[model samples]
Structure formats: C-alpha cells, structure tokens
Target: MPYRHAWLFIVTLICATIFAFWRTYFSILPEAAIGFHIHGLTASLWLLLLLAQSWTPHHGRIGMHRALGRVTFVAVPLFAAGSMAVIHSMAGGTVGGDPFYALWGARLGFIDTLALGALLYAAGMALRHRRNVRLHAGYMLSTALPLISPVFGRVFNRTIPGLIIHGPQDFPVFGLGAQCGNVLAAMIALWLWRRDPRFGRPWAVALGVIAAQIVGFETLAHSAGWNALFLTVGTQPLPVLMAFGALAGVVAVWLGWRLPEARGRPKQDA
Candidate 1:
C-alpha cells in the first residue's frame, strides 16, 4: 500500500519513454534492428507490469497483485536478455567505427552495464524482503531509477536548449544529458529517503547505486581499459552475450527468493 500513487509516476515515465524514443525507435520501427525491437517490447512490458503491480494493491486487489507478481519470474530474464542484446548491438557499432558510437557508445554501454547491475540489485532486494511490505515496495519502486537516465537523457538532448553542445570531435563536450538525468534520479531517491530516514535502507541503497553509476560514468566509462573490455565483449556472439545476461537474471532471482529471511524484521502486508 505504500506509494499508493506510484502508478501515476510509472505512467509518466512511460510517456517520457515514448517521447524520447519516438524518432529513433517508435517512428522507425520497421528500420530498427531486432535487438531494438526486443529491448523496446520487453522494456515497455516491464513498465506496464510495474503499473499494474502498483495499481492492483492500491485498489484492494491484493489477490490480483500476488498473481501478477508471479509473472516477474519469466519477464525478468527476458528483460535481461533484451538489455544485453541492445548493449551487444551498441558495442558492435562502436567496433565498426560509427561516428556516434566511436565517441559515445562505449561510455553509454558502460553506464548501461552499471544500470543493469543496479536493476538486478533492486530486484533481488525486493524479492528477499517480500515479507516486509515497506521494504519490498521500496525496492520494487527503486527499479525505475535505473531507467530514468536512458529516457530523460534523450529528452534533454531533444528539448533542453544548449544542454549538449558538440565539440570539434562532433560529440557533446560533456555528457550533460546523462548528468542531468542522474541528478534528477538522485534527488528523487534522496527525497524518498528523507521521508522515511529512520528505516530507509532501500532508498539509501538506491542512492548508492546511482552514485556508483555517476562515478562510473565520469571516470571508468572514459578509460582505455574499460573500452578495451567492452570491445572484447562486442566480439562475442550477440546470442551468447544475451544468454549470459539472462543467466545472471535467473541466478539473482533464484538466490534472492531462496535466501533465509533475516531475524527481527517486521512482517507487513504482501
């Protein structure tokens, strides 16, 4: 029952995603690669699942909520696969010397890897704390945080005046779009944590994840070693990379769900 109005926020994010990817994905759906289609469909489904999950419990449909929660066991692995597919595609582009990829793709790929890590952490925590309603809800909701940057960064690139000025190399001098998005996500997490500062481990963890992403983006993403690693990953078959991602998701879910509950935690409505 926490975050009773969370569906509204999820809806807004869905809208933002559509607006941000209209030109690149939605509008040119036919021209987009298979990886894009997989990622787009799975991502949209995850958001919709979140929306339903939020609304059902708030509307006194606890049974429905529990039923729908079972779907995540299947959905999450597919989501992971889609995410890796896109990352693999980006790496290939970078290796192929596409102008945009040559400059920014590696960095974005690295950030995305961090984002995936954050998502898996949140998902695992949510499952592990399922008996504590507040903790479970907090971690479930935190899943949205990792997705904010990819959507809003594009929005900033399109809408914010002078937000991304290209340099002589023809890429933005700085990752202003990503920075703005990360700042916004951090503020939201901080605000949520402040609201329940005494027992806000979920939000604190979320904040830590975001901070790691920010630091990684500013430093490691630009490093020669990271780029080399990414290029090596790119050389692997796309299906192999996607399978690895799917396995990671499955392992996270299994381990989290199978773990013993910690002592002294208060039980809450599921």
Candidate 2:
C-alpha cells in the first residue's frame, strides 16, 4: 500500500493510544510512575518515527526515510526496554499485594515481552526484504495491535464489564480485552491476506504469534511451573531486567542483519 493509505493506520494508532491513556498520561499533573512515563514516551517516539518515515517517502524524500530507518536499530531496543520497565513496575504493585495477583502480573508481563520481541523480530526480518514492501508494512503495522491491547482491555472493563467471563478470584478484564484484541488482529490479518496472498506471509506470521500468545496466556495462567518462573523473573533485580532488554535488542539487531539485501525488484503480484 502507498504511504497515503498507510498513514491512516498511523494516525489511528496515535489517536487510540492518546485516548486510552488520557487520564493517566495526558493529565495536567499526571500521577503515573517514572517507568510508565518512560514506556509511554518511547512508544510515542516509535510511532512518530513511523509517521515521519511514511511522510518522507511520499514527499520524494527517500533519502530521509532511509536515514530514519537506521535509527530504528537504536530505537527498537529502547522501546523494548521501556516496555519491560513498565511491566515490571505494574507487576510489582498495580495488581495489589496478593501473591496470586503478583503472579498473574508477572505472567502477563512475560507474555507481553515475548509478543513484543516476536513482532520486532518479524518487523526486522521484513525490512531485509525491500522487494516485499507490503509484507514489510504489514509486519510493521501489526505490532500496534498487541501494543494497544491493554488500553482497549481497560476500556472494556469499565464500559462493558459483564460481556466476558471473569476469573474466580479477580476480574480478568485485561485478559478479555487482550482476547478481543487478538480477534481483531486476526480479522485484520485475514482481510489483508485475502486482499493479496503474496502479502500474506507476514500477516500469517503475526497471526501465528498472536495465537500462541493467547494460548500460552490461557493455559499457563494456572500452572504452578509457570507461576514459579514468573515469580523468579518478577523478583529479579534491575540489572537483570536491563540485561533481558539488552539481550532482546541484540537479537532484534541480529535478525535485521541476518538476511542479504533484497534485489529491490518489487513483486508484481503484490
């Protein structure tokens, strides 16, 4: 798709994120923690980067776009790091002091990090194939679907509280919201795949990841082994979190550099 068409998705994402976090992020005296601010700012930077990259290419500034693309190697990891920080902070206290709540938060955070890592890996891989710009764009854009799940999940909890099943002890509002997000993402992926089967690969990969994430979240929510793992990770020091972020960053960069440069021949079918 052309930048003009793609720009709509970018705008929609920006608007949705802002609206979702309006009370916490956009307030005059926002009471959110430092970690949230870091996460929010970094996430916003990524979206802005996407917007700029899209805008430049349409304006006949391919050089500028490529330059901005280089910065992604640095920005992508920071985005990942900030995300982990937010998750850790939330898991630490936001869910209350109960051990089960803490375990649930850790589980959610771990799965979220995995999802983000998978999408980043896919996006980086897509970039290596310049010929399949549609596929690349599909991978890049699909990352937002999961990223925004929490926002919509919280919204659903407050607005349509009883539509979904709640967990035995605590309300599983976020999980329901994420499930709704997964379904929406799957629908979008299917629609795009049907539009051009040639562009289906990335969408297919993204859908697969989303499916696995949902399955893992559901199956392991009550597993003793998984909770133990989450507890270990959740109790780790700041250095460990930083190390995990750094390792994920390295993997993303390695993936970006793994494949040879594309021949630049645009696929005729897609």
Q: Top TM-score: which candidate number? A: 1
> What TM-score does candidate 1 get on C-alpha atoms?
0.95
- Candidate 2 residue-wise lDDT, 1-270, digit = tens: 342566677787788777666654678336766667777877888888878776776777978978987877877777777777776666655344754355457557656766777757765775666556675666666666566456565555445747332443545445676667666666776776677676577667777776776777788655877666655655567456855775787677677667775665564323
Candidate 1: residue 245 Cα off by (Å): 0.8
What tens digits encode model 1's per-residue C-alpha lDDT throughout 1-270? 688898999999999999988877899988877778888888888888899999999898999999988887877887888889888878888888877778788888987888788778778888888888988888888889888888888788777777643443525643788878888898899999999875588889888888887888889999999999988877888889889989998987887798876878787854
Distance from true location, Cα of 140 in model 1, Å: 0.6
TM-score of each: 0.95, 0.82
Give the Cα-based TM-score of candidate 2 against the true structure.
0.82
- Model 1 whole-model lDDT (C-alpha atoms): 0.83
Lowest lDDT 10-mer window, candidate 1? 165-174
Residue pairs in candidate 2 whose N, alpha carbon or C atoms collide under 3 angstroms: none
| Deviation (Å) of 146 in candidate 1 | 0.7
The global C-alpha lDDT for each of the candidates, from Candidate 1 onward, is 0.83, 0.66
